[model samples]
Target: MKAAVHSRYGPPAVVRVAEVDQPSVGDKDLLVRVHATTVNRTDCAYRAARPFFVRALTGLARPRRAVLGTEYAGVVEAVGGGVTSFSVGDRVFGYNEGAFGTHAEYLAVPHDGPVATMPAGMTFEEAAPGTEGAHYAMAFIRVARVRAGQEVLVYGATGAIGSAAVQFLKHHGATVTAVCGTAQLELVKGLGADRVVDHTAQDFTRDERRYDAVFDAVGMSTFGRCRRLLRRASSGR
Candidate 1:
């Protein structure tokens, strides 16, 4: 199999697609023929060994895993003996963290890992990049304690995290206010946002309405800027 590999951490040019040995499938593994994958910030951080401290986990000297992808969407070419939840030819997509190795022609994912069957009618390309964004969105939403009927604002609503956040927030019964560039207003609205704000023409922070929570999925808003938008704590207690 061929993979985008980097022996030493550096720029994008350091990674080169090269022939590498295929992963051996253990009893609980699914050998997938990868059809699509995503390159996100996590991949870039690992590839460049950014923040310096990631080396403590990835490697002090060099990356322990040469393949740099963290997510994959593919069809199962084979399944290990112990695997039952999935079978050969099943379409699946999954996410991994430290155990990154999806940027390749083929990948072996654990049967009980973060993997799941692709949603009905969804293409591999759409499902490939959805895992991480949905995972992170769920984490952040839980931390925010979003609830039904509460007003919430999501900045950068066009990107992965923000887009998923909008849908997740809506599913939680929160009234979502999605902020994005002019081009993505309709798309964000289609994601179930109750209202869409084009950040280019207007200032969302200056809106008279307050929210139960404000999610800055793209790191474009500081807490200080969004503080005024959040509803104040009840004083009765």
Candidate 2:
């Protein structure tokens, strides 16, 4: 098998395609022939070994895991005897920020992990990029306990996570106020946001509408800045 591998942490130049031993299938593993994958921020963060903590996952001296990718879409070439959820020839796509091996010709994943059957009529390229961003977005929405009819504000609404957040919030029946740059205002609106704010032209925190949750997708805002925009709790019932 061949993979985009890096021995040391640095920029894009550090990685190269190299032959590597294919992963052995575990009792619950499925060996996928990767058809599509993505180069995402997580991969770059790990490659650069930025923020220091990333070293804990990769390596302190150098990268322990040479292949760096977290998302993939492909066909199951083989399935472990214990794996019944998926079988050989199943079209699947999924991601694991902790599992960085998808930028390769083959990837082995636990059948019960984040892996799922690809949606009908969707290509591998389309499904491959869906998991990483949507996973983070869904996590935030779940943590916030966002519900139908709730008002939620999303900052950095044009980003991968933010774009998914807008659509997910709308799917949950929330009234979303999305904040993005001027160029992405229409794109965010097309994602089903009830209102869109041009952060480049005006500050979104100054908006009048109180929100049930403020999702800073790009990690640019602090709690102190958006606290005033939150709906205050009151004694009721």
Candidate 3:
């Protein structure tokens, strides 16, 4: 099998495709023939080893796992004894954080992990990115406990996480206000935000209206600055 292996990573140049031994299937795992995968901020952060915190999950000296990817779409080549949810040739797509080998042609993942059978209507590429945005957006909305009819602000509303957060907040019944550059104001509004703020032209905090929650999707704002624009309680980053 060929894979983008990283023994010690510093940049994308460090990663190279090479022939490696096939991974053995485990008792509670499924061996998947990867059809598609998505490169995301997590992969870049892993490669760069930035912010220091992410290294804890990989390794201190080097990466614990050679391949760096979380979202994958593939077909089950074989299933372990304890697995009954999927069979050989079943199309599936989901996340794998512990065994991050989605960049390769094949990967072994625990059946009971974040992996899920791909929805019938979705394509491999479409399903792959779902894990990251959906998972984080859902978690953020829950943590903030967004209420119906309340004003919710999503900063950096054009990015990966911000795009998902905009919809999630709207789905939760909050009157969403998305903050973005002038070019993305319409795009964010199209994502179901009730109002859009062009951050280039206006400072969001300077606005008199206080929001129930202000999600700084890009981690640009601190807690203190967001507090001035929030209604007593809010969450960011």
Candidate 4:
């Protein structure tokens, strides 16, 4: 099996395509022939071991294994003894955070781990980034407890995560206001944001109105600044 092997942590140059032994299927596992994968911020962070805290999972001295990838869209080539959910030749897309090696021709994961049947009318590459975006956006919205008729603001509304956040918040019934640059205002509005604030042109905090939740999707907004944008009863860290 050909894979992107990483012997060291640095840049994309450090990742080499090499022939490695194909992984064996364990009980309750599915052996997948990876068709596509996404290179997200987490992949880059793990590859560079940025922020040092990420090294705690990869390794302090070096990476545990060279292959770096997470979200995968692929077809199952084989299945293990206890696997009933999927069989050979089923199309699927999902995330594998710990066992991050989906950038190869073949990879194996437990049948129950984030893996799910691909949605109707979706392609592998299209589903690849969708899974990752959905996961993070769902996580934040869950934590925030956004509700219908409540006003919520998502900063950085045009980013990969931001775009997803806008839709997720709307899906959860929140009246979402998206913050982005002027160039991305239309894109944010199309994603279901009720209002689009051009961060370059206007400061959202200066508005007299407050919101139930203020999500700094880009981490570009300061704690004090965002806090001021929140209503007194809904302020949260």
Relative to the true structure, how large is the alpha-carbon lDDT of every model? 0.88, 0.90, 0.85, 0.86
What are the TM-scores, per candidate, against the unseen true structure? 0.92, 0.94, 0.91, 0.95
Q: Which ten residues in a row have the lowest lDDT in candidate 4?
A: 228-237
lDDT for position 53 in model 3: 85
Compose the digit string of candidate 4's lDDT tens values, residues 53-83: 9889999989996787889898999999998
Question: For model 2, what is the error of residue 144's alpha carbon versus the real structure, in angstroms, after optimal superposition?
Answer: 1.4
Looking at model 1, residue 196 earns an lDDT score of 92
Tens-digit lDDT track for model 3 on 66-157?
88788999899999999998899999998876668898999999998888889898888888887887777778888877778888888889
Preferred candidate (TM-score higher): 2 or 3: 2
Q: Pick the candidate with the highest TM-score.
A: 4
Q: After superposition, which runs of candidate 1 have C-alpha atoms over 4 Å from their true positions?
A: 234-237
Error of 2 at 140 (Å): 0.8
TM-score of 1: 0.92
Best-to-worst order by TM-score is 4, 2, 1, 3
Query: Which is superior by lDDT, 2 or 4?
Result: 2
